[model samples]
Every structure is written in C-alpha cells, then in structure tokens.
Target: MSSNGSVVPRVTTRTLQKMRDNDDPITMLTAYDYPMARLLDQAGVDVLLVGDSMGMVVQGHDTTLPVTMDQMIYHAEMVGRATDRAMVVVDLPFPEGQIGIERSIEAGVRVLKDTRCHAVKLEGGAEQADRIAAMVTAGIPVMAHVGLRPQNIHVDGGYRLQRDTDRLVADARAAEQAGAFAVLIECVPSSVAAAITDAVKVPTIGIGAGSAVSGQVLVTHDILGLTTGYTPKFTRNFAEIGKAIGQAAADYVAQVKSGGFPSKSESFS
Candidate 1:
C-alpha cells in the first residue's frame, strides 16, 4: 500500500514498460521538495522527476545550466525520502553526463547511490547512445530525453518546436537500441511524436509533444499556476493555486487587522 492507504503497485521502470505494453498512459510530474513529493506520490503520480529545471523554478536561474550535481543530489534525496511508490528519477545536471562516458557513468552511479533514486535521466539522442549504453552496462537505468532538450536551450536559442520527423524517429530508435528503458520527447509536433513513439519499443513520455505518446510529464508548478513570470505555451494551469494562496493570505491579514481572528472560542486561555 502507498502512503495514501491504497494498494497501488509501486511504480518502477518495469511498471512504466508494462504501462506502455498495455497501452496505459504513464503520468509524470516534476517535484523538487519533500512536501510536494509526498503529496504527488499520495495522489498516485507514476513517476516523479527531480528535474534540473529546478534551476529555473526553484533557484530563480534563467536556464538549467547553473544547476550543479550537489544541488541535484540534495533535492533528489528529499524527493526519494518522501516518495513511497512513485519512481524517482534525477537529471544529470548540465555538463555532468555530457562530458564523457566514464564521467557519465560516475555521475549516474553517484545519483543512484547517494539519493537512492530509481534511475537517472539525461538529455540528447543518437549522439548520446554511447554514454547511455555505458551507463546501462554499468547497471544504471537511463531515461533519454530527445527533441527540444532544455539543456541545449542556449544552443537552440529558445524552446522552439522540433519538426524533423526522421531525426526525431531516429533518435528515439537509437536510444531504445542503446538500452534506455524509456525516452522523453519534448516540444515536438503530435505527428512527429506519434511517429517516434511507434519507432521506439520503449515508452515515449511527452512534454509539450502532444497526446499520441505513451505518457505525459509537466513541471508541477506550471500545472498548478504557481509559476511566476512567463508561462510556456504548452503549459495549462489546472488549478489557480497561486491565486488561492494569495487570497487566503489577504483574508488572514484583514482578519488580524480587524481583531476578528482570536475572539471567544478562538482564544486558548
């Protein structure tokens, strides 16, 4: 049973594969802290990613490049500790896994050992096949990210939609062949995402990549309307939680100023 007191099966890499095989959609959400991880897990989210996007969402950085391995490990540890069933996967922060095969393997090993996360996710496609293969060979389960990789935000100029059908399909196939248990496709057209999903044997998790893929992921803040500043085109605020929080705070302030908060029964004395 999970923290919610329900007997849902614990989600794992094999669970994700089974979902794909059975044509069941996988649900993923990004979580960086203990409270959020606990909530999402209890709500039965299948996977919780401690994504490097924490650089932007949590640390107030412009891009994910500034996130470090130490920061990732710290956050991953919190999420892993809080989660009872949802599989936790931490990102290999920029330049960590991209450097070399040995470095990549070392980073993956450290993430799994230190955080006790189920797996690690890395960005790149065919070019990253060697690193993915090496990590899997070393016993690290890898989830590959292709299409609009946020790690390449600077190089790509911005979060533009990926349209190259042949390349996207090839990347997905190569990652699967390289032993990645699943692949994440980001910011691509639905047609292209669908093709790639068909091309790969493993599950394809999409973010801004449309509905034809096997699964979907979104940053929790983005979906909850908690994100400030600019919101992405692909994001939909499922709940106005930020507004509700602000309204609650405003109500509390008004009650305190009017001396209406601690009257009669509200007093402990």
Candidate 2:
C-alpha cells in the first residue's frame, strides 16, 4: 500500500523475466501523455510504450520517422510521470538508432535520462546487431523490432511481411544474441513467428506477426477502436469506443433538440 493507502504499483526486470519463464503473455500499449498512461497503468497493462507511432496518432504525421529525438523525449517524460506500475519503454526514433554504436548509446542515454523509461525499443536485425549489443552493454535494455519496420517504410515498399523463414529465424537469433530482452515481430506469417519464438531465448511480442508468438502488442488507438481513419489487416478491434463516443454525442444533440434533456428537476435553479 502507498502513503495514500492505495495499492502501490510496481514492475521490475524480475517481473518481465517471470513472464518469459512462464510463457505468460505480455500486454503492451502505447501512450503519449499523462492521462492515458495513468489509465493504462491502473488497468494493469504490463508495459506502456512511448512509441514513435505517436507521430501519426498525436502529431498527424504520415510516418514515425519525421519525429525528432527531442519530441520523443518530451512525450516520453510526460508518460513516465503518469506511470507508477507499468514498465515504460520508449522508442528511439528513426535515425536516432542508425548512427552506429556510440551514437546509439548517446541517443539511448539521452532518452532514458529524460523519460526514465525501463527500456528503449529500436528497429534492427543481424545487420544492426552490433549496435544493439553496444546499447545493451551501455545498460540500455533494448527491444528489437523485426519484419515490417515502419521507419523504413520507403525501403520495405509499404510494410510487407518477411516471406523467408531462414532469414527471419537468423534475424531473431541475432537479436537474442545481441542481448535484447525481447523482440517485436511485425507483419510476419504465424508459422514464422512461432518458429522465431522457439528459436530465441528472449520473448517475442507480435504486432501483425499473429497469435503464434509468445505475446502481443498493439497501438492503444488501433486495438481500442479509436482510430476511425484507417485500420490494418492484422489489427483486431476489441471495442469500438470511437464509434460509441460519436453515437453518444449524436444522441445528446438529439435529446437537446427535442428538449428531452436536462429535465426541470435536473436544471440549475
């Protein structure tokens, strides 16, 4: 219990390791600011990611790349302040992770110091394994992203899945070997996702990688049905809060128009 007599919230590396050891699924959702972060923490989300996806969800950017390190830090800090129990992980935006080992450490430290996130997630595979190693060695827990890397949208030619099993397995192993605590597999076949999880020691968290992986992660807006503008094939809508909210507002307007709302007893006298 806390000083306020509420149940204190806490998460640690041991908790994450227990999840991996028990094959217990990890739940992660992105939050850009305070209110959402607090709500997610209260709702028992295992991890709260300050993903660069915020560029699209909050800033209206077409891609996550256009977001700057400073912008990431600012949002991360906000989310961190609201987080008491959930493990906070912040994304090292596009080019922020591309500039080799030393730069990666610098970037990781800058973000970590600013936001106090439990770890930092970055996109890479065997090709960038050395950088991942360097970041890990520098005490930054890394969450590797494979398959459809949104930061490389131009090169991947629009978020396609990896069709080659051999390559995917190799990349997963590389990430694990490079000291990542977990890997995020995006837009890969379910069979391939299963194979990768079996091949690696670290937990595999899937976005579009299907149900075969160890755990699942979704952008808060995407899964909560808040995003009405677009939808992805792999994303499942558990609740359509957006539509419900719209309908509720419409109903309120109708009630007012018909003078059915704010009945005499309820009116401010």
Candidate 3:
C-alpha cells in the first residue's frame, strides 16, 4: 500500500508499452520538487517528468539552455525521493547530448545513478538517435523529445509551432529505431501529431501536440493555474489554485493583523 493507503504497482517502461498496446492513455506532468512530486504521485500520475523547463519556470531563466546538469540532478533527486509508483524521467540538460556520444551516455548514466530516476528525456529526434541508442545500451532508458524543443529555442528564434511533417515523422521513426521507449511530441498541429503517433511503434506523448497520441504531458503549473502570464494555447487551467492560494494568504494576513488568528480556542491549553 502507498502512503495514501492505496495499492498501485510501480509503473515501468514495459508497463507503459502494455498500456499503449491496450489503447490506454498515459498521463505525465512536470514535477521539480518533493512536495509536488508526492502530491502528483498520490493522485496517481503515470509519469513525473523532471523537465529542463525548470530553467524558465522555476529559476527565472530566459531559456532552458542555462540549466546545468547539477541543477537537474538536484531537482530530480527530490522528485525521485517523493515518488512511490510513478515512473520518474529526468531531462538530460543542454550540452550533454549535443556533445560526443560517450559524454552523453555518461550524463544519462549519472542522472539515473544520482537521482535514481527510471529514465532520462533528451531533446532531439534523428541527430539524437546515436545518443539514445548508446544510453539504452548503457542501461538508461531514453524518452525522445521531438518538435518545439525548448533547448533549441535560441536556434529557432524563440518558441514556435513545429509543423514540418516529413521531418517530424523521420525523427519519430529514428527515435523508435534507436530504442527510445517513448517519444514526446510538442507544439505541432493535430494532423502532424496524429501522423507521428501512427508512424511510431513506441508510445507518443504529446504536449502542445494533439489528442491522438498515446499519452499527454503538460507543465503541472499550467494546469493548476500557478503561472501568471502568457498561457500556452494547448494548456487548460483545470483549477485556479494560484488565485485560491493568494486569497488564503490575504485572509491569513488579515486575521493576524486583527489578532483573530490567536483566538482563545486556537491557543495552547
């Protein structure tokens, strides 16, 4: 039984494969810390991706390129420690796979060893196939990210929708051929997203891409309405948690100022 007093078996790569084969949808959410990871795991999220987007979302960087391996390992460790059943997939930060294949494998292996995460996500498709294959050979499961790679934000002149269907399809096929257990398709049209899903044998996890993929993932902050500005087109705010939290804080401050927070019944006996 888990801490929530329920029994849910640990999710593995093989389990995800079976779910894909059975036509069940996989769910993933980005988690960067222990509290969020624990809560999401208790809620039964299928995968907790320790995304490099933490560079922008958590650390206030302009791009994911600034995130380092040490930062990723630190955050991933907390997420891995908090998870009970959900598979943890940590992002291999910039300059890791973009370098030589050996260094890339080393980086991936370090993430798995240091954080105890189940898999590592790399941001590329065809050019990353060698790194993906090498990592798999070295016992690190790789999840390939195709279309709208945030790590490539500099080259693309900022985040834009990727709709090159032929390139996207080739990348997905290369990643599947390279032994990636899953592919994350991001910021593409529904038609292109669906085409990649059909082309790839492995599970296709969509972000800004559409619903036809085998699974879906989004930044947890976006879904919870924690982000303040510039909402992505594909994400829906399921709850206004940011507003609720602000209101709760305001109420507490008002209560404390009025000395109502320490009422007779609230004091120690």
Q: Score each candidate by Cα lDDT.
A: 0.92, 0.86, 0.92
TM-score of each: 0.94, 0.89, 0.96
Q: Relative to the unseen true structure, what is the Cα RMSD of model 1?
A: 1.7
User: Candidate 2 on 1-269: residue-level lDDT in tens?
Assistant: 34467976577666776787897888888999999998888888888999999888888888888998888899899988987788898899979888767877998998778776888998988987999998999999999998888999998788677778888889889988999888889888999998998899788899888887777888888877888587888888888888899999999999999999989988987
| 139-177: candidate 1 lDDT, tens digit per residue | 999999999998998899887999999998888888999
TM-score-better candidate, 1 vs 2: 1
lDDT for 152 in candidate 3 is 86
Which lDDT tens digits does candidate 3 get at residues 1-269? 58669877899999999989999999999999999999999898999999998988888877788999999999999999998899999998998869899988888888888886899998899998888998899999999999999888788988999999999999999999999999999999999999999998899999988899999999999999998668899999999999999999999999999988989898998
Q: How close is candidate 2 to the true structure, as a TM-score?
A: 0.89
Provide the clashing-pair count of each candidate structure: 0, 0, 0
After superposing candidate 1 on the true structure, give the runs of residues whose Cα lies further than 4 Å from its correct spot.
3-8, 261-268
